[model samples]
Target: MIRTIVGLIIVLALSVVVISSVPDYSLPSGLQGVGQDYTERGVNDTGSVNLVTAVVVAYRGLDTLGEVVVLFSASTAVVLVLTLVPMGANPTPSSSIVAFTSGVLPGSIVLFGIYIITHGHLSPGGGFPGGAVVASAFLLVMLGSNKIPGKSKLLASIESLAGVTFGLLGFWGMMMFGQFLNNMVLPAGSPGKLFSAGIIPLISLVIGAKVASELSGVFSSYRKAGGDE
Candidate 1:
């Protein structure tokens, strides 16, 4: 109760200070912010029409790569959990639901996911969301059929390859331009084209494949733990 009261008091004090300073607030002028600079030169620098994609995949490529590592770690943890604790048998689904999920939804989801990842430089969606969608295709298969389709070993191999490819590309860029993940190694063609962004698409594809394979492995582990055939 004392801690709650103190928290409320602090909130009230901060609110009062903000209210007092509201009238004095004025927008700064003269120098354009980095955001404006990114907008102005994003296409020219990264050859990606989507400024957000350029910022994420080019300007902050290292950070994006780190995020992929974090995701891979999380998926590994899930696999470890499955190894430790066996899951229960899954409840059977309706025939119609199974048919739809197995026959129709998986293909559509896979296609859309690939499209999203490949066209990320020109569109709003990127590798992360696209990867999740691709994983959902595996999930649909799991739910529709009583058995997991792909072998976990294959998925693990692909995941490892993708991670290695990403790291190798970064090193290659560093070797060529003296800067890690530098886009200067590859020619950045005209913006708004499919092949405009040099390494962005390649990186996105790797990330997508890595993520999809990792998540699929996680799902397969869970399925095996559940005693599903």
Candidate 2:
């Protein structure tokens, strides 16, 4: 009861503080400072037409790295939980329609995911979404097929390698250019082209690989842990 009271007090206090602070926080009318700079020089500076990608993979690449680390930690936690959880569930395959679609769609889904990852610098998709899409393919298989998929060891190895590759590329940039994950390591080709944007695509590839492997492994583990097979 004391803890509950304390929690309520804390929540109320926070709410009061936020309400008091609301007047002091004004919404920006438009882009200013860094935003302005990124808007103006982002394309020429990073050779990436997609300003967001330029910022994520070049200007503020460390932030993206931190996000990856967070994801890795989460995946690690899930794996630890996997060990604690019993894997005694046997999943029966789904109906014929689902089985057929699983066989049919996975290939296309995987291909589309790769396309999204590779073309991230030029388009609306990136590593996270693309990887999730790929992982969904694995999920489809798990839901529809009879055979157990996602070799945990292989997935883990791929995840580790992808993570290592991401760091190594950053280090490579640091060694030669003194900036980590510098996209200027290679020629930032003409914008809006497939070969443009230098290291951005490479970074996306690794990020996609890491995310896909982690999610696929988690899905497989869940399926084996008594979820829908």
RMSD of 1: 4.4
Estimate every model's Cα lDDT from 0 to 1: 0.84, 0.86
Off by over 4 Å in 2: 1-27
- Candidate with top TM-score is 2
Residue-wise C-alpha lDDT for candidate 2, range 1-229, written one tens digit per residue: 9999999999999999989888777889989998999999989987788788788878888999999999989878887798688775566768999988988999999999999899888988878789999999988877786655544578989999999999999999999889888788989999999998889989989989999998988777776666643
Q: Which stretches of model 1 miss by more than 4 angstroms?
A: 1-32, 148-151, 227-229
Per-residue lDDT of model 1, residues 131-222, tens digit only = 88999998888878764344557888999999999999899899998888987678899888898787988888998999899988887887
Q: Positional deviation of 189 in candidate 1, in angstroms?
A: 0.6
What is candidate 2's TM-score against the reference? 0.85
